[model samples]
Target: MKSNRMVLVFFILILTLWGCEEEKANKEVKTHGAYTENNVAQKMDKEDKNNEKTAKNQDDNNSVQYFIEEEDFQKFAKKGLNPFGQEKKQINLSSTDFEYYIHGMTHQKVKAKEKWDFFEMHPKRIKWLLEGLEKTKYKLGPDKQKYREILKRWKQKDFSTIVEDHNFIWDENEGTVGKATDRLSQEDEREYLESEYEMMHHFK
Candidate 1:
């Protein structure tokens, strides 16, 4: 009987140890699973934040920045309208700067096709410049007067009238100067006229 009791005790102890080991293994599995899930969640959160930041940066890069100074504006206003080159170096300028270069700088004869491209690329800037010319006050001068009349026609979107006046200027006729405005009545028109007009007589 004593021997039987000893065997029974030993069997119970083995069972208890096996149960404890199994419980410990279960706990370890749960901890590993939870750790994996937490790591995956953290990784997803980090990716989302990175994507948001990238999108914000892209938006900032897409924004447009154009700057124009008074000296540049005056230089352009005096130069009258001229042809702008079709090179990327020219086109890469901001819309406002592009206008200054086209109207302010002198260039060799520009093809009608190139002018058309400029128009197509910067219609808004051109319109804004034309409108500004109509409203801004200028010093007393004939050149200023002629430019005012040209701006008037341009504001009306009358390309034909501009061409006609340009022709008159080409013919060296004083009559091309429209009715004198309060501004620029005292200054000579010679200063405003382009020294070298290279545009074709008419756009195609």
Candidate 2:
């Protein structure tokens, strides 16, 4: 019986030693594989930051910046704004500017078939345009020798060529420019002025 008791105690001690060795083995285990979660998250964060930076750079690239002085910028803004061209304000501008602006306004208004609905629905803009032309005549052109000689004796209101009964007078009732306002577009103005090239000979 004593021998059997000793054998049972020995078996208990072996089991205790085996449990301690297993615990130590578990503690000593070192992982040898790659770091998966943290490394992946860090790489994704870097990629996200790079993508954000690239998008920001692209947005900056899309902006156009022109370097110019304030006066030049303002002047450039005004370039091509006036479609009438410098011929309208030129020193030696011909009579065509006055006649063309007068008639061109009619061309713009006559297309508006429904706004006024007058006898034939003529636009009031045409009349406003004619009045503007008459007002602009007071604005002087280039003081060239030919212009000076012509205006010396012929005032804008009295010239037969400019104020003739069939052109200058605005007959809204008749839808016409009377005698002085007969000259039409650039082409018509050129041809009509050529008809009076003999009158211009005296100025020469």
Can you write out model 2's per-residue Cα lDDT over 1-204, one digit (the tens) per residue?
Answer: 999999999999999999999987766553212456657889999999988866754553344121223454345347732223222433333354434443332331122222111111012322333334345435544422333332332222222232232223133234422223232433443343353344445777
Colliding residue pairs in candidate 2: 91-142, 165-179, 166-178, 166-179, 167-178, 167-179, 167-180, 167-181, 168-180, 168-181
Query: Which residues of candidate 1, in runs, are more than 4 Å off?
Result: 65-204
List candidate 2 stretches off by more than 4 Å. 1-10, 21-37, 62-204
State which candidate has the highest lDDT: 1
Query: lDDT per model, in order?
Result: 0.42, 0.39
| Candidate 1 residue lDDT tens string, 86-105 | 33232233433433333331
lDDT of 1: 0.42
Among these predictions, the greatest TM-score belongs to 1
